[model samples]
Target chain A: GESVGLHLPTLSVQEGDNSIINCAYSNSASDYFIWYKQESGKGPQFIIDIRSNMDKRQGQRVTVLLNKTVKHLSLQIAATQPGDSAVYFCAENWSGGSNYKLTFGKGTLLTVNP
Target chain B: DVKVTQSSRYLVKRTGEKVFLECVQDMDHENMFWYRQDPGLGLRLIYFSYDVKMKEKGDIPEGYSVSREKKERFSLILESASTNQTSMYLCASSSSTDTQYFGPGTRLTVL
Candidate 1:
């Protein structure tokens, strides 16, 4: 789904299951993309990032897939844990911008059930 | 590891009063930014500083200003705070080429 505002699309997963969060960005020129996890009462924490050149990147138990043609990004989490319950944000960076600032999407609150 | 620190986790302010939010980074990053998070509005850029003494306005910078006197610190200023400004302010820092490291965040309530 598109990022309309502060509303983040959510993904619910059972413990020990895999979870996938999706985001669709607006800028085609964005060269880099990053995903973040923000727990309640805390700020957004960096999870993983991918450069536009690469369609897919893997991390420790996590993977990021980029579809430039669709301007979409997804985060895959393995073996979901309750600790994984938090709002996840996807950010895009266009190197052409003056500040190279990242544009953040609303976010997806992933709820992992134990 | 990059560590970004904010002065306050929560704050209260009155309308028409000035407000300041401070952010510091230990990574000696050259770039720092300020953003506001609101319900159903996502995170919007307020301002950013690319280097000491250099600052730029982001998309929604009409009511905010920024200062970066040193490479490690960035401050956001509200000339005349308004209730509409009530939201979660996040501070972030990045080197010339790296991911942004965020602070815990500052929740400001304007009444």
Candidate 2:
């Protein structure tokens, strides 16, 4: 079965440094991808998303890059802060009907040191 | 803001007990979903409802069921809770074409 997965399970960065989280998806039919941030004791919050038509999309201090050929996706965060410490997940939405259900990666735990 | 709320933040139930987890969304979205998150397992969809009185089984729906009596509410039910059912359950809602907004998840422990 095709699945989405992260390259790293944990990442540690210092404050003000740039951070990157990587994901690889196996389903070639996936047309939409999203990044989510989950703080401790909370649900995952939507961060940014990109459609397969575009390779890159940017949101407030964050960018999502997609590589359809390689079936890879990545999320970049700028000026990492202590508050940014959390688990980040990447989800792939395959092209289909109106269900809009997503397949999520296991997630990467990000730790930002102040 | 799209706010999705769950009935409880933490719940503990005995084995064989019936468990119900309620979720409500204020955005009046047409789609709602239930997922269980476990360590190293990511998020597995339990069930989803696209409209009132309509339901669909998701990837992992063997031990769970759902109810969507109203447009704003969706509920997940465990017929017979077991220790293996313990996990963090999350609820989300979205329009047919919109991104999903999630609730503060409910941590369930079946002892």
Candidate 3:
């Protein structure tokens, strides 16, 4: 999501439950969108990716939905575990041909409570 | 498997000191980028290079510089460390496809 004013949006989910995090992008020319997970001390790891030609893509226990009409994207994790707790960010790229720069979201902190 | 390694996990420097952060990628990637991640502010691109000896200033380039003398190595240099520059610095590399692989970030604190 875009920066509202000064703070980033966050979500907390209970362990063993499902969780959904949403993001809105501003680029209309972006052809690829991706989601990344980052722990407290590590860099962002790739979770999933989707192309503008596709509306939905699913990975192992994680699903990503893209709505190009509204430039919105969502990530769904089934049976969220405590290890799933981290900061999630959505990035968009226009990598159809030439060098494309990736634009990242403000990030959403997901806390999975046990 | 792709591997990206950062020279340091944590770094602290005094004000007006010159700082250098190193990054190495095992995969032969042509494009490398340097970014800073803050608590509230997401990741902001500082600099990027597509080829050795070629560099471009990203969205925010003030007070930051970058060097890419080799294909697998990219270095970020802070001319004079400042308190405002205290943040998590990340280095990333990608094939021509643009799916980036990031290294373990280096958290730089300037006093």
- Pick the lDDT winner: 2
DockQ of 1: 0.82
Ranking by DockQ: 2, 1, 3
- Each prediction's TM-score against the native? 0.94, 0.97, 0.94
Cα RMSD, each candidate: 2.3, 1.1, 2.5
Writing each residue's lDDT as its tens digit, candidate 2 over A12-113 gives: 999999999999999899898999999998999999999999999999999999999999999999999999999999998875944898889999999999
lDDT of each: 0.89, 0.94, 0.88
| TM, chain A, every candidate | 0.91, 0.97, 0.89
Residue B17, candidate 1: alpha-carbon lDDT? 98
Q: Report, to 2 decimal places, the DockQ of model 2.
A: 0.88
Chain B TM-score of all predictions, in order? Answer: 0.98, 0.99, 0.98
DockQ, each predicted model: 0.82, 0.88, 0.76
Residue A15 error, candidate 1, Å? 0.7
How large an RMSD does model 1 have?
2.3
Highest DockQ: which candidate?
2
Off by over 4 Å in 2: none
Over all chains combined, what TM-score does candidate 2 have?
0.97
Q: Give a tens-digit lDDT track for model 2, residues B20-98.
A: 9999999989999999998878899999999999999998999899999999999999999999999999999989887
Query: What is the CAPRI rating of model 3's predicted complex?
Result: medium
